[model samples]
Target: MRPRSLDEFAGQEHVVGEGSVLRRALDAGEVPSLILWGPPGSGKTTLAQLLSAQVGAAFEPVSATSAGVADLRRAVERARVRSRSSDTRTVLFIDEIHRFNKTQQDAVLPQVENGVVTLIGATTENPSFEVNSALLSRSRVVRLEALGDMQISALLDRALADTDRGLGSRAVELEDAARRRLIELSGGDARVALNALELAVMATSDTNGSARVGPEDIEGALQQPALLYDRAGDQHYWLISAFIKSVRDSDPDAAVYWLARMLEAGEDPMFVARRMVILAAEDVGIADPQALAVAVAAQQAAHFVGMPEGYLPLTEAALYLAVAPKSNSALRAYAAARADVAATLNQPVPLHLRNAVTSMERAMQFGAGYRYAHDQEGGLIEQQHLPDGLTGRRYYEPTDHGAEAAIADRLRAMRGVSPRVSYRDTPRPMIGSKRPRGQAFGDRTLHFEPHVPLIGGRRPNTSRSCGAGSPIPR
Candidate 1:
């Protein structure tokens, strides 16, 4: 049953609750051209109708799927005539407004500008991307949230008791279990809940002048729950973000749960695999160096085997990453280096560090004082490898986690710096103890940088090769 008035409307208290902006506007008979953006069955159409009636405006409804420019022009003409003759406003309600192309949307802009019709456009897509700038600027977008369980329950109760508009005439009695299951299956859509409830009552056998709806009846009526997901819409981004964050937080359970959600919802398995691959490098890093290999193997396995069997490797990779020691040192090192590259002017490699491929270059002492590590004791010697301007800058800071611990110790030894005590050797931090800020290496503080998506295919201008005399092409 549709809500006839704002009072009867459930949920979206932020939009039309008492003392709210839209509520005040509607009460003052000053309804503006609006864009209602939300999921299906969230009462976009019903709210538009109620708003039109509240202002005593002539309602002209059109579906973007079936209505074209001609239909829109006719509606505008009707609004013009009505406004001139009877001094009545017109509310042109377009459902699925995102379906309208730029040309079709443009056709209505002039009418809206002149106030021939107060447009109320509804869309399941984000208006920022789908709606054109001119029309979007003119209309105020009101976002409606999905109905919560309590709100949906209230709507069901109202439907069962109202004989005039709901299924109250049938005298249907819904079992508590059936009601809960129906609400769960509806996915916060009041229209779906009401329709399924009506179907369940109609299908169930009448007993003692009343049809009793059980869990089975409700399940049968619904058949399958329609997941609130659009592959190319917000759901895609939201689910993937949840999955990545869960893995980064080292919550294996949450990671797997999100993975299953995405996979079962028909998200491209390859996309999930690719993101996992990036996560292995960006989150797991050298803490568990094998994490990258596992992620890569999973990607290959998924591509080779294909679903539904492909989920096997995908699940294994997700678990491995979630449990692996976490480190963003690799990510941080790259970011530090990248920032320097972006900020500083191109600095040439030192003459000693450059290759002298030609006789003429050798005569100029290009390879003059470079100490080859292979000729030095222990294959390590103190030498300036970086350009003169950046002779002592350290970029790669190895964390004391997993395999990186040994690397950190080696690096300290090479740099003539004493290694700090290992964190694993010490007693673990007590539960609820304040975690040390950033990457902890005993008493030393190494700031951990947050993960940032890498922009691929960018190279520094001063990059050079050891085997060639020329600078590497950018």
Candidate 2:
């Protein structure tokens, strides 16, 4: 049975209540171009259908899976003709609107802007990423939430007794506990609730002239194979969530345990492992640079090994990722640097830093001020190397933790002296390749300049160079 009006719509009162944007739009008897974003079976299509009924507008529907730019063009042309013939506006409902690529989205933008068809696009994905800015700019995004336990309960209650639209006359009685089971199984998805209800009702045999559907009956009615994830049931999202949170919480033991649950369910180890890798970086950064390396290695190991066996490396890596001291400073630094570069896109490089690989290039301004650091006292010098406006711009701010402290110390010193100057004034270069073993740069300074004279008659230079080349400055 068709729901007569918005009042018949269940849940999401926050969006469908009086004065709510959607509520007001429907009451105004006009629905503009809009995107309804939410999870599956949240009544997006139903809302579109209701909009057509309530506003007395003709509705046209298309699936993005099959609809292309040409398909959208045709729909718009048909809508235009329909308005001309029936003197009525048409609303084009696109399910999975996020599936539309840029060109497909662009094709529909003009019509939506010109009001040729009031577009009602629906998507389960984040529309901000899938929808182009221009299309999104012209559409108001309406969010739909999953049905709550109470709402789902009410839906099941209605389904059990509504004679016209439900299987009430079929001699079936749903136990309260069983009803709760169905509600839990539905995962706030109404369609799933109805489908499960249908299965349970159909399975019920007449008990004393009235079929009594108990928890067992309902359980028996469920799909025999059991869905990989009960999209509507309790087991679907809960485990995935637990798995991710376990990794984030840094309980390697818990992380591995949850991972086992997913893997046992035939979950994609690569998907699970990929997320672990992200957690490794996003949740565990410079505090343990090895965490990311471990994660990457595990991903490759998992990919090559595949599941069952591949899960071993994944478990080991997950443990390391969970145990690693957490830090996001490096990730943040990269983001800051990226933001700076984008703001100054196409900025010209300084002439001195430009490559002078060709003989002619060296004659132009290329490498004009470039220096060789190896020629200096401690392989140190000062010079400008970045673009004119962005020289010495601090992008990566290392955190003083883990092995990163060494990096911070080195950066501290390098910051004081320009890299270009180090390259120029140094007795050596940045080293076209890794320096030979034991061939270190800088003064091996175990000897102090008598910052404080020895209180006791001790060796003045207690520290001695281990080899011919040492990093310590004399």
Candidate 3:
């Protein structure tokens, strides 16, 4: 049975409850063009109906799947006739409005804009992506949540007791456990709960006067309720979202369960594998360097082995990723670098770091004085590598998780030069030309003096060319 009034509406107190924006609008008879957004059987259509009736508008309902431009025009024409006869305007309720393509949706715009009808669109899909921007800008989106167990139970109770529209006329007795089973199978859907209840009542044979419906009878009626999944539709995205979140949150059990659900629901194994690979890099990252390797191997394994058997590698990878030490440092570092590039495009490379592949480049002081890092004592060098403006720009900030701890330590040791060169402690860029006297960049040393002692002994005054092709000044 459907709720006749806002008071009777079981859930969605956020939108239809007392003092809510929609409720306030309804009270004043100033219902704007609106979109009712929610999951299936969450009463999006019913809400639209209630809103139109409350505002005393002539309700003209149309299914977007079946109705085309001509049908829309006819509905508008009927509304015009209704307006002429009475003071009441029309409420054009478009069910599954998301199903309407951009061109089809645009066709209804003129009618809605002209106040010929107050458009009320109901959609299980997200309205932002599905509904046209022009239409969205003119409407208010009211999101409805899936009903909870308590709400579903209440609806079931109402169905069992309501005489007029419900199965109150039948000689049926619904047991407590049977009621719980119906609620579980409904998945917080009122329509589903009522339908399952009806099936259970109709199938049960009457014992003397009343037919007692047990959990077994309810289970039989439900017969493994089809999971709310469509491989190419909204549920696909929703399940993947949940799966990703579960892994990110480090819940191995949830990660495995969602993985199984997607596989069982005919989701592409390759798609799942791709997502795992991305998650490994984006979420687990260098904290667990093995995660990316595992994910990639899983993808290869799945492709090689094929379905049914392919699930083994996929599940193993998902579980491994879920338990790995988490770090988004690599992802964040890339984001920061991208922002910098966007902000300051085409920054020139430092002279010493530039390649001098040609003689012309060498003459221009390109690759002027870069030293060979391996020739140095500790395989450490002090050199200007980053573009001039980004001398001390620090992008990669490693967290002390898994293998990243050693990376963080090494970075601290290498980047640590002067007391002023503490890039790790302070996030600001080093602006001035003050270079650390004996600081090492990788392995080579930046010796301004003509003759600095070499690792073993100083070489004789011979013409020695650096890696950058700069001749040592004699």
Candidate 4:
């Protein structure tokens, strides 16, 4: 049953409660052109009707999904005629107002501006994004929230007891368990709860002239819970946001719960997979380097397998990311470097770090004093790799978590700073380096000796050449 007055309204106390702005305005017979924004079954249409009744105004209703510019003009003409002939105010209620296009919404703008009809636009979307700015600016937007369990229960009770508008005259009894199940399935939508309750009562066989609706009856009436999700609406962004935040907060349970909610509600699995990939890089960076690989693999697996089975890999990746060691050092390092790039003048690369590809370039000393790390002891040499303007600047600050702890120690030693522990004992082979079997740098022997040539069946020269013959610096 729809609320006939503000007093009968079960939820949204903040909007129309005693001493509230809309309540006071209605009491004063001043109904402003309004935008009622909220989730479905939140009493938007009922509130509009009540507002018109309170002010003794004629109510004219239209559905934006079906109404066009012609329908709007006709309604405005009727209101204009009524206003002149009988001085009666008309409340033009447009349900699903966000469905109207720019042209259709624009047609109502002049009518509202000139006070031909007091427009009451009801939308299940954020009016700011869906409604045209001109119309939104002219209307006082009032946000309605979903009804809570207590509010829904109160409404259900009213329906069962009120003989005039509800099912009270049918001698129907609703079991407590059935009521709870109905409320849960409704997802805080009062209209769904009331309709399902009515169905349950009607479907139950009479027991001695009175029908008793139990949990089974309620479940049968509502075959499955309708999830309150709109893929192109606020729910889409909100669910994904919650899922990412839960993973970032390292709550595996919450992460998986939100993941299941999205998948069950028909969200694009690819969309969820993409966001997870981003989260793995942004939130679970170098602290556990494998996190990025896992997220990417999950995305590929989900795409390859397609949904139903795709959710398996998605769930696995969500758990992996949630429990993995986290570090934002990579994100912060890039941000710090970006700030320098923006703040400083465009600086030239150091001459030694540049490639001397041409003879003229070699004469200009492009590769003047660049040291070859392969020839140096420990394959590490003290060098100025940064530009002259950024001689001592540091970007990457590895954290002491998971595999990054070892990296941080190695970096400290590379920078000639005393590390918390020795890292030289575990020297690994440099990437793409193929040293001869007996070659040694200082006392550390090369553990990885390739049997075949590294590139094109020719042994790569491992010398201190810095001119044209040397490989270009990565």
What are the per-residue Cα lDDT tens digits for candidate 1 across 145-211? 9899999999999999999998777778899999999889989999899999888887875665479
- Cα displacement (angstroms), candidate 4, residue 439, comes to 48
For candidate 4, lDDT tens digit of each residue in 1-474? Answer: 887778999889999999999899988989999999999999999999999999999999999989899999899899999999999999999999999999999999888888899999999988888999999899999999999999999998899888899877877878889888888888889989998988888788575546899999989998987787899988898999999999999999999999999999999999999999999999999989999999999999999999799999999999999999988888777765665565444668999999999999999999999999898644556677767655566567677987787676555434432122111122322323432122211243222221211233233476432332223221
lDDT of 2 by residue, 1-474 (tens): 335678888888887788887778788877778899887768899988888878888889999999787888888899999988988899999999988888888888788878888889998777777788998889899889888888777777776677898766667778988888777767678788778778777667656546777877666766542333533233445776787677777777888887787777677777777887787777677778788889899999999988679989988897887777666766666665565455555667788878899989887979797787787656655567566645545546566767676565555544533222221122321223533122212342221121211212232365442222322232
Residue ranges of candidate 4 with Cα displaced over 4 Å: 207-209, 417-474
Ranking of predictions according to TM-score: 1, 4, 3, 2
Clashing pairs in 4: none
Candidate 2 Cα lDDT to native: 0.72
Give the Cα error of residue 466 in candidate 4, in Å: 28
Model 3, 1-474: lDDT tens per residue?
998988889899998889888888889988899988888889988888888888888899999989998999999999999999887789999999999999999998988889888999998888888999999998998888889999998898888788898867767788999988888888888888888888888788575435789999889988988777777677899899999999999999999999999998889999999999999999999999999999999999999999999999999999999999999988877776665565556678888888999999999998889998777655767677778766666668778999897676555444444212322333333335433222212232222222222322333455442333232221
lDDT of each: 0.83, 0.72, 0.81, 0.82
Q: After superposition, how far is residue 108 of candidate 3 from its true place, in Å?
A: 1.8
- Worst 10-residue lDDT window for candidate 1 reads 465-474
Candidate 1 local Cα displacement, residue 447, angstroms:
12
Q: TM-score of each candidate?
A: 0.86, 0.64, 0.82, 0.86
